[model samples]
Target: MPGPVSLAEQVKEVWTSDEGSMAKDTASNRWPKIVQGMVDDVAETAATAVDRPQQEEALSIQAALKEIKDDMLQNRVLRPLPSDGRDDIDGYNERLEQLGGKCTWLACPWLFGECYLYRRVQTIFALTHHWRDYDIFKRQKDSTFAKSCKAVEELSARYMQVIANSTLPGDATNEEARKLLFVEMTEVALWGNATDLSLLSNLSLDQIQSLQGREAIAKSQRNIVDNDTDAVWQYLSSPLRFNRRIDIVLDNAGFEFFTDVIYAAYLLESGLASVIVFHVKDFPWFVSDVIAADVESLFQHLESASIFPNRSFIDQVVPRLRAHFDSGAMSIKQHSFWTTAYSFHQMKALAPGLFKSLQVSSMVIFKGDLNYRKLTKDGLWPHTTPFKDAIGSMGAESGIKVLALRTNKSDTCVGVESQERVDALNEEAPHGVWIRNGKYAVVSFSDGEKTDGK
Candidate 1:
């Protein structure tokens, strides 16, 4: 067999080439807009700064934002991060130094550079006195959620019905029904990934609605080229159901997050999980990845009849969701490790606290393409590499159970049964177009049981 494909090799592919693909678009288009958005926010907020020192701080942030934008457009080398007391900053700076102190915008490893961009943007706020709590992406995140009202209403109604019909745990008579609902809910979460802001930047209201709901999911079932929902259900329904905590490392907010919450609600209500922990990013990341604030924002939106335009649906769902939050059946958490350059494979060595936290959970679900990429080290694995092998250290028996629900939006993937399936997919759409489009998906699971003592 050939040696593992390195990030150096992967970067030369069309996916990361400066010509096209989301990576190119992100570097060329999204990064400038992101910096400009922050500049605008700084300007807007400066008007309200009460003191001269605060006004000066806001001005400094604006200056930094301009520099950030210029650096991206010019493809300038990534600069070292100033000390921010966060543990991850040193790690980022270390990586920057290791990359010859000159990793350019369009040429660096896509995953690392993308993460670095967010971290660099965040450093501006960290250094500020008056703007530490400001979220530059808040307007976009809120607007996107507001636009997703239709899909939110539809999923809310469906979720309520599923909860109503779900059987209590250990009900042998309803086993098949519960399993079926598991598949449905997992698919709902999977397809929710189709609308990430970083990639599908121009999705209209109709386009978003078309990607959601039961009918859309039914129509797109054939697109799930690699599914392990049965394995997921089997794990959840296992006999060793004592310490049942389900941890979700979240992805994009708005509709996707809305779906994930309902899925967690179902798991709690149906007794599949005793508690649910949502792991969110500590800062604005990948434009739309959830932060802890988004959970409350989602609930606030759901509770507003004016925003959702479905009083009955909101009434049915909001209270139960609130109950979960109130009773601590559901909780949201964040850690610096989530936004760091290190992948999940390095979690144990780099972020042991987080790894230890996950080790105790019954199941940990990694959502969307980025997490899947990080889980697999963002390397181009042979198409037939087992999901467990692709994940490296995280797949060891001593590690935590992991389930990846991802829509294929990147080149890296594993755990398909055969290479022939990949060939057929390529024949359908040559030159790897089939994988980059969000139409295809994978529901991959790893038992996290060590076969050999590594």
Candidate 2:
């Protein structure tokens, strides 16, 4: 007989019936809509196919995607992934097998269920000959990026000023200036995640603009109940941080990615880091998660004459980005571990190499809600739990300097001061709104200390 579920396993389970739960809403409402949209995108591809073979493959993929949506709606048992030559397939299937008969879309852990849906969607395209490399989420990603041009232009002007003025290789002369710039750029990057495509799907151009810009950013400062601005800045700006290498496990593409790039540029320019390594998803993921192609595509958009009217800003910024790539100051890395269903706490055992590589970095910045969820294990941690304690192995014991920047959009939250503040916020809003509204944020940081649990 299967062993009784451990306390750890019990916390991992995020059932769809939990009242006022994002997991429940996602499994029931959000997922079907997402999968059906993929079916529509695939149908469009099928109709536009140049040949019969391509059309046939597209139709098959569409059917498979539709089936996924139906399964979610029907709450069918979660199945092991079909063998697809991918290295991570076994790990996913094994996870399902371990669950025995209790696994289903609305009944399994929220984190695993969400990952399975995306991977299953990717599998449909993987099995096809003609559409194997096709990105079903490409249209939506590009469209959203295009829609965020105003914010893009606004940020461009702000970022270019810093790039044009700052010194590189050494900038210790103006300590206060560097510190202020770091705070501004980092905050810009933190809140950029408010527009994650997986949540807030129906945001208009005006709403997008409202979430960005200097005025909007300044206004959102009060919403950051848990602040680590000083802690992160003090560490990054410290004289001890020579030869710094910053790794940003990225979130959304387009506008958010642009903000991240700007933040990276500030680090490189102010001599904060010698190099920046961006971590991207190996496959298309979570609607807008950074894939390899999106990075290049963003630069193309940056250089576009019609999309952005500020040629002077574009001329200054675009080539600088290219230079970073050319000079090896900035690079992109992709590992399949990022797209897996497992929490980052399991990284030590599951993806030892990736975990080891990250240990050498100055700091690893996890952007957006999903990465934050993975870091914190997406569990029912009390709102008052310390951020360091919430991340388990990814915390102080692992000796990884970790910074998680996310606008809240789910149930798992920690690192706030007290239960009183949480109670006050809840009283002012609808139930569960304070935690998942995407209006509030947390900038939590931890050091690489094993001795005292820094």
Candidate 3:
């Protein structure tokens, strides 16, 4: 059998080749537009600067953005991140140098280059005065959330119904029922990834709604190709369940984030976890990855009568979320490692503090495709490779339980039961198209208990 194909090798396949996959679209279309949008935003914000120095800084930032866009279009070699006094910049530059000192936008590793693109964009704002804390993607994230009102209402109503009927801690009568609810909530969180902005850049409100709600989930259950939710439930319900803290490495901002919060709320309310810590990126990332401000934005939007039309549902749900924050049952945390290009396999070495923090959690749930890719080192491993093996150092014996709830949207996947299953999928869809469509998913878990090196 052939050894696993690295992401760089997979880039030569039609799915990742310059033909039509996300790599092509991202480098050729999405990034240039994103940079142009940032340029426009800087111009608009600069007009409102309070003083001359701030205005001058904004203009300089705008010029820097334009130059970055040009370099991307010209396929120039990737450059080192300017010294921003942030600890991670050195790590990023070192990685770039390791990859090859002359890697270009299109020619470089897809995962690393994509990460580098965002980090380079951050340098422009980091060096600026008034815009240092601004999020270039905030407007897009907010607008996407605004447009997802229908889906939001449906999920809020459904989540509330589940909560109303759920059995609390120590309620043994409906243990089976509670288990079913856990599956449903996990599925809800899994499918919510359909709305990620990186892949569905032109997604419409109707398109988003079609992918959400109870009906959508019911119809899509069969599409979950590799399900370990039962194992996850067992892990959570066993002796290891008590006084548990669950860490969520979050994904996109809009509807997906809403569902993720609902899942966290369910875990807390069911006493499956004592605390839920949400890990968000420190800056704008992959277009819509959640950051600290998004949490605030979500609550503020829920509070505003003008934004979301479902006032009754908001009234019921928003307070529960706010109470989680108020009573310290929930928390939002950020780490520079999340935004860095280093894969989760490198977590122990690259970010030991974050690694140690996750070790204390009952299970750390990594959400969405990018997180999945990072977990597996974005390698084209045989589809039947065990989930634990794919995750490397973060797998068994690492003392950090992990559950990856992801809709397959990239070329890399593992943990399926057999190569025959993967062959059947390829036969059905041809050319690995089934993996990138976002119609299928994987609910994979690692128990973190094995001590053997094998």
Instruction: Judging by TM-score against the true structure, name the best candidate.
Output: 2
Candidate 2 least-lDDT 10 residues: 197-206
Each model's number of backbone clashes?
2, 0, 0
lDDT by residue (tens digit), candidate 1, 1-454: 9999843345322233446556776677877887898798778877877888889988888998899899888888888888777888889889888879867887777788888888888888887877787787887888888888877777777777777656545455457556656666777788885443222112222332343432443554667777777778877777653759999999999889988998899888877899999999998898889998988888888877778666777788889999999999999898888999887878889888888998898999999999998998887677677887778778867468889999888777677778898899889877777778877888888878977321
How high is each candidate's TM-score? 0.87, 0.90, 0.88
Whole-structure CA lDDT of model 3: 0.79
Model 2: CA > 4 A from native: 1-13, 164-174, 194-219, 451-454
Cα lDDT, model 3, residue 8: 38
Model 2 lDDT per residue over 109-137, tens place: 78888998899888887888988888888
- lDDT for each residue of candidate 3 in 312-419, tens digit (9 for 90 to 100): 777899999999988989999999899988889889997999999999888899999999989988876778878888888789789988999998888778888888
Give the poorly placed runs of model 3, Cα more than 4 Å off.
1-21, 47-52, 168-173, 195-219, 239-241, 451-454
The local distance difference test score of each candidate is 0.78, 0.80, 0.79
Candidate with best lDDT = 2
How far off is residue 60 in model 3, in Å? 2.0
Report lDDT (Cα) of residue 250, candidate 2.
Answer: 98
Q: Rank order by TM-score, top first?
A: 2, 3, 1
